[model samples]
Target chain A: MTWVYAVTLLILLISLIVGVWRVIQGPRLADRLLAAQLFGTTGVAVLLLLAELQSLPAARDTALVLALLAMLAAVAFVSRVWKVRPDSEDRP
Target chain B: MNLLIDFTLLIGILAIALTCLISRSLFRSVVFFILLGLMLAIGWIRLGAPDIALAEAAIGAGITGVLLLDTLGHLKKTGNLENDEPAPGRKRLILAIVSSFTLVGLLLWAVFNQPTPAINIHLLVTEAMPESGVSHPITAVLLNFRSYDTLLEVGVLVLAVLVGLALQTDQQAQDSLPGLPNPLLHACLTLLIPAMLITSMYLLWAGADRPGGAFQAGAMLAAAFILLHISGIKLSSQVSHRMMQAGLLLGFGVFLAVATSSLIGGRPLLTYPEGGAGMLILLIELALTLSIGLILLSLFTIANSPPHHKDQGGDHGH
Candidate 1:
């Protein structure tokens, strides 16, 4: 079970790292936002895995928090897009 | 057997991640990212963290996807601004790959090499499990044993909302105006909303017996609200009254109230007095779920609000 959890965590970590690369290399803000969302998803996965590995009870709570935070971040990013340019084509 | 499942899920997650990063269309990337969230949720479940799985499904896949799509709409409006830039050349891509692998290698090493903490949390949980009315060690630890962390976690959420409010200037009311709320959409909401409510309630009430609690319930409620918002049921600022704010703070408020009363009853802060903890936790979860839903919906609605008041008078105000 621990081994399964460890491998899952490892895969998630890789996903996050790749997502981070996308964030840095993003030619546009929208791409970066997408990448950021991936990062948060991976973070939640990591927390869940940790909860299992350590037998910690807060893994779910932490994951929940991460989800909410990710939503907020995504919303904020979207709003910024709306704010910066009213049209769908403005580049920042 | 477990290892096989883990490897398969890992491959699936990797594929999703690759598509999310490499996809050219913004819409496609958004969809893939949501899929990635789903896969990650399954990974959590496979790892034996059902609570985390619930959270990841509701918050990670559901709400985050909505937010991303909304942002994508904005990006489309912005026109191909970023796409104008050249995609990374081969040399840069190769360098990025090398560096990312190195970072991963280092992280893996750290994970494997870190000396285990001296304290045996498992032993502590086992020893203290008898004292907790709750059977699930994680729930007991979260709410009964190390509830301080939980309290602070709630506090962090409140603080984030406050910061969001403060940062948001010229907030326009994103109230749902009379538009064709599609019958299908309404139908889905009717079914899903009630079901979600029941599940949220169950999560809170069952925290003592199973892998559910306030945080899970709260996120679930938030997911329902997200659905409503996307379907055009907006969260109006005019309705964010003192009661609404109180509801938002209900989790922290109820927990504090209970914890303080415990002192007078001769127990420490947050120490549930025997069987009472389960009920108290339920009450907290219920309140938290409602507030969390409202909070999340409000934040997203406000964020998606057009800058000018006239700009948001109706559906997709131009």
Candidate 2:
């Protein structure tokens, strides 16, 4: 069980890394926002797995809190991106 | 056998995460990420944490999805979504790879090295289950024993909304619903809204007896709102009116009211008076589920960006 959890987390971390690449390499702000949202989602999964490792219920609550906060962050980022960038059609 | 299921679920999660990270279209990535959240919710259940599972399904998959879709919409309205030339950065790829390895190494080391504890307080709560009216220890912890945490959590949620409002667009007049409409979409909304309401009520009522609670209930209500949005039914800012606002705080309010009243009786806050305590807890949870759901949905709706065209091809309400 522990091995599976470990491997699963490892794969999730890899995905987050790739997402970080997108965040940096993103040509448009939307892509960066998407990458950040991906990171947040993966963060929630990581927290849940950690909770299992520690056999702690509070960890799950923390994960829940993180998940909610991540969603909030995504919304904030999107709004910010929208405010900063002009519509694509406006560009030459 | 259960471990095998766990392995399979993990694989599914990995696939979704990879897709979410690498999808060509930003809108499609957001949709996939929401699906990924749902898959992760199932993963939580496989790991024997139904409380986490329920909460994830509601907030993680349901409300978060709406917010993402909303952002995608906003991007669409701005016409900023496009596959442009890659930013001048091959160095970023190297940095991402190196940091990813660093992160995984740290996680593996910590998971392996951490000493397992001998006793878990959750078990203690289980043992003392008879003293509390609630059957589920987590619920008991959430609403009774650790009711203070639950109260503060709701406050955190409210604060997040306040902050989100301050940070995001203040377009109170522009409804957050998707623009397009389809007959099938309408059918789904008609079917799902009632189911959401019933399930939310059931979850709140059964919270003391089972795995449901305010968080789960709030998520369900949020899910219903998401369904409404995707179907193009916009909720005005006044969606949750004055009574609705009060009801949204019902869980915390009742808990505080009962807890304070108990002070006169020389009891701690959230202390139940023997047999009648279960009803009080249920009432609070029910009101809270309603209030929390509305507040969360309102937060996402207000924060939601208009949908971009490409997001339409992604998963629909699953």
Candidate 3:
């Protein structure tokens, strides 16, 4: 059971690495923002794993906070950076 | 295997930090910086501090990310951000490299070579918990054992909001008109906002026994408010500037009232009577939660206001 949690955590960390790679190689701002969203999701998963592995339930709340606030960055992007490209909106 | 995970996290943190610094576009860098904050939050969790983790995720990443993105937008609007800042000359580059290396070396040495503490405050806190107001050592410490520190911390937040208000020239008084009418997004927020409210209240109450507290609850409330703002629900001048000012000072005022009231009973300032400490702490926390939320919401609202408002209108600053 412990190994299962560890392996799951390892996979999440790998996903986080891949996410960072995408952010760095981002050809568009949206791509970077999406990659960041991926990190938030992955980070939450990792926190859940850590909570299980360490037998600490308070960390669960951290996961909850992450799950909730992850979209904040996206909402911010849409609010301020939403360009008036009705035609190019489908590019993503 | 555990050490392997820890080491990998360290590497990830370093990689993300470097990317945030090296990225060409300011906006992309800010995005990466949020990722770095999440990684750092995870790091804090591994170190067995969920309180810090909660704070990092909520305030460090969530609120700060919004502020940074807003700043980037402002800079772009004013034609200040170049896609690429010019490369540093060799002389400056070499100087940067040397200074960074020296700083890194000094930090590494300091972290590994620090002497052991003469006393473990953790043990002392747990030992004193029975006498303090609460079962949770952190709550006890912050509100009972060292109430002054917490009081001053809340004061600092109030001061920050006051400074933000003073600097708020209202040049950008345009309340953000929603970019597009998305009923779907509105529906989602309608569901999410209630949940956020419940969670915030839960956090405010849970501080007595768990890792949640006024700061976390207040920040979550502020997030909900900001989200609502983005969805076109203005915090409007309907909240009247005077009423808003009172809300900004609500926590400090409550704290001062409670702390001074205790002094009349022949106790020192902020010293709760033997059995009433818990109840008083809860009362103070409830008020602090409100003030903190209002202060944060006001800061966000002020930042979004137009720079100049000769003819004040809806959503204009005081």
Candidate 4:
């Protein structure tokens, strides 16, 4: 079971690395923003895995908070930053 | 396997932080900064500090990211987002590198050369836990044992909000950015906001027994408020101005009153009376939670509002 958690976490970390690449190689701001969203999801998964792996119940609470707040950055990005410049939708 | 996981996390955190620092685009930098925070939360968990991890999740990943994105929006609105400032001079770069290396070296040296303490603070805390009025050691330490520090910390939060308020000339300065009137966002807020509020209360309640506490819960509450504000439900307008102000100060006022109440009993400041510690700590935490929520929201709204100089100029012209 611990190995299962470790393997899942490794896979998630790999996905996060790939997401970082997209963020870095972004031809568009949307791509980077999407990558950030990916990180939020991946972070929640990682936290949950850690909670199970370590038997730390509090880590579950952290995961819950992370899951709840994950969309906030996207909401802020779309409403406040992205929508401000309709013309620069693809601008990096 | 554990070593591998920790190693990967360490490398990942450092790499992300470096990328965030060096990213040429401000937007990319901000995005990477958020990523760094997410990674750091995991790192905190790996280090076995769930309390810090929770704070990092709420404040570092959530509130700070939104604040940065909001600032970027302001910069974009002012047509300053693409302004390419010159990079630092070579001499300055060298200074920065040297200083950073020196700091790292000092930290490593300190880590390598730790002196044994004469007294085990953990032992003291364990012995004192029964009387501290909380099952959670962190809470006990924060609200009961070292409550003076908590009191001052709340004072600092209040002071920060007051400063932001002072900077605004008009009490009712309108936010320049209109609420996002997306139908889907509004629909989602129906579910999300309540969950956030419930979670906020849960975190507060959990603090007495677990890793959750006032600051993390306050940040959660602030996130909910910001979500509503952005989604077209302006809390500032819904509530009376006087009521809003009182809400912002309620925590600090309650905390101060409680701290001073101890003085009346000839106890030193912030020391709870015998057998009353639990109630007092809870009362203080309850007030602190609300005040913290409002203070954080006020900071956001204050930043969201456009500068008052333009409004003042228009008034002068009229």
Candidate 5:
């Protein structure tokens, strides 16, 4: 069980590194933002794994909060980008 | 294996921070900055500090991302974003790299040289936990052992919103993005908002025995309100300024009232009567959750607002 958790966290860490690489070579603003979103998801997974491995329930709570707020950046991105574009329909 | 994980995270965090600093595009850099916050949240969890991790994920990564993205949007609109992001010349880039490495070296040196003989606060916190208002050590510390600090922390949040609102009042009203009128989004909110609210309230109430607390709960609530706003729910307009003001003050007001009432009881300020500390702390936490939520929502809304042309005739809300 401990080894399984370690492997899971290892995979997450590798994925995070890959995501940061994507951010560095962003072809567009959206791509960079997507990498950040990936981080948020991966982070929750990693937190959950650690929570189990360390027997600390607080890490699970942090994961829950992370999962809950994950959409905020994406939502803010869409709203602000569209609003500033000067062409959003008035939700008719 | 643990060491390897820590080393990898360390490298990843450092690389992301450097990338955020030197990324040629301001927008890209801000996105990287948000990513940095996310990575830092993970690091905090690894260090066994879930309270800090929750705050980092919520406020550090989530809210900061919103504010930075909004600022980038404004800069893009004014054409300042592109103009100000001229690529660094080779010499300047090298200088920046050198200086950053030196700073990192200094930090590493300090870490390695730090003495470890200081009293262990973990033990102190644990020793006091049963007597403190909350069973959770961090909660007890924040609201009971060092409650005056918590009171001031809430005050600082209040002051920040007021200052931000003051700076925002006469500013140009930026175009609000139309919350897309889609049944899916509406349906999602119907389910999601309730869950978010329930979780936030549970977090507040469970704080006595768990890792959650008013600040995390408040931040979650604020995120919920922002989510609602983005989904075409016009909560800000429905809530009159007077009402908003009342909501903003509710947390601070309740805290101050509790503190003063204790004073009237002939105890020192903020000292609850015997066996009443738990209930008092819970009450303060409840009001604080509401006020903090409103303050954060207000900041979110104000940041999204457009800069008004100084010559345009606009009515200030203040």
Candidate 6:
């Protein structure tokens, strides 16, 4: 079971790396923001796996906080940042 | 397997940090920084420090990310987002590299040549735990044993908010970012806000026996407040100005008052009376939680508010 957790965590970390590539390669701000959102969700999964693997319950709380704040960046980007760049709105 | 996990985390953290530092796009840098924070939180957990992990999650990743993104928005509004900042000259790059390498070398040297402690401070904390008024060692250490440090830290937070407040030329300036008028966001808030509030209180309650505490709880509360503010539920406007000011000062005031009371009792300042340490710590934490929340929200709002002249110009133009 611990090994299973380890493998799952490894997979999530790999996915995070993949997500970072999108953020780095983005020709669009929305693409980068979406990749960041992927990180948030993946981060929660990693935290939860760590909690189970290490038998540390507080890691679960960290996951919960991550889950809650996951959408915040998107909200901030849309309402604050993206709204200002009207030109970027029509870009693919 | 554990070694593999640790190795991956190390590489990921280093790579993310380097990217954040070197990324030409400010927005990309901010995103990578947030990702780096997430990675660090996991690193903290791997080191068996869940308290620090929680703090990293709440403040480092959550609050700091929002603040940076908001700053980016401000920069965009001012047409400075794409301004070509001059690349570092060769001399400056060499200086930076040399200084950073020197710091890293010093750190590595210190790590390799650690001196044995004259005292087993962990043992002392364990021995004194029964008298420290809390079951959790971290909380007991933070709010009970080394509470003076916590008091000063709260004072610093309060001071930071005060500086931000002072910098605002107009107290009543409205936030330039209009409320997000999404119905889905509003629907989500109905559920999310309550959960966040409950979690904040639970964190405060858990501190007595677990890893949660005032600072983490306060950050959680601040996140909820900021969410509401972003979604158009302006907490600042809902409450009176006097009331908001009082809320911001409540934690530091209560902490100072308690510390002074201890001094008057000849307990050498900040030393709680016998049998009252637990209650006093709880009281201080409760006040700190509220004040920290208000302080963080104020910082966000102060940054979000438009400049006084801009507001006036827009008003006259309209």
- Highest DockQ against the true fold, candidate: 5
5 or 6, which is superior by TM-score?
6
Task: Give the per-residue lDDT of model 1 (tens digit) for B1-318.
Answer: 446556766886898789788877665576577767767876776676777777776767767776776665554443423544468899999999999999999999999999988999899899988777778888888878888888888778888877876766654544322222356656766776776667667667667777777777777777666655655565443465676677777767876787788899887777887767666766666666676777776566556444445535433443
C-alpha-based local distance difference test score of model 1:
0.66
TM-score: model 6 vs. ground truth: 0.94
* Span of ten consecutive residues with least summed lDDT in model 3 chain B: B309-318
Residue-wise C-alpha lDDT for candidate 4, range A1-92, written one tens digit per residue = 88989998998998888889899999898899999999998898898889889989898999999999989998888878887752233222
In terms of TM-score, how similar is model 5 to the real structure? Answer: 0.88
Lowest summed lDDT across 10 adjacent residues in model 5 chain B is found at B309-318
Q: In candidate 3, what are the lDDT values of residues B1-318, reduced to their tens digit?
A: 899899999999898888788777888789878988899999999999888888888888888887787667554544445787788799998999899999999999999999999999888898888877778777888888899998999999899998887777655466443343567877888789998888889888888989888888888888888777665577764577778788878888988899899889888898888888888889888888888888877766777555344434433223
**Sliding window of 10 residues with minimal summed lDDT for model 2 chain B:** B172-181
* All-Cα superposition RMSD per candidate: 8.7, 10.1, 4.2, 3.4, 3.6, 2.9
By lDDT: ranked, best first? 6, 4, 3, 5, 1, 2
lDDT of 3 at B49: 88
Candidate 6 at residue A43, lDDT? Answer: 90
Fnat for each predicted structure, in order: 0.03, 0.02, 0.58, 0.72, 0.68, 0.67
Q: Which ranges of candidate 3 are over 4 A from the true structure?
A: A84-92, B113-120, B176-180, B305-318
Q: What C-alpha lDDT, on a 0 to 100 scale, does residue B13 get in candidate 5?
A: 85
lDDT of candidate 5 over B225-252, digit per residue (tens): 9888766686767888789899999999
Docking class of 2: incorrect
| Candidate 5 CAPRI classification by DockQ | medium
Q: Which model is ahead, 5 or 6, in terms of lDDT?
A: 6
Candidate 1: regions farther than 4 A off: A1-92, B1-4, B77-85, B88-99, B175-180, B235-240, B261-268, B307-318
The weakest ten consecutive residues by lDDT in model 4 chain B span B309-318
| TM (chain A) per model | 0.83, 0.81, 0.86, 0.87, 0.87, 0.90
For model 4, residues B51-109, the per-residue Cα lDDT tens digits are 99999999998888888888887677655577366888999999999999999999999
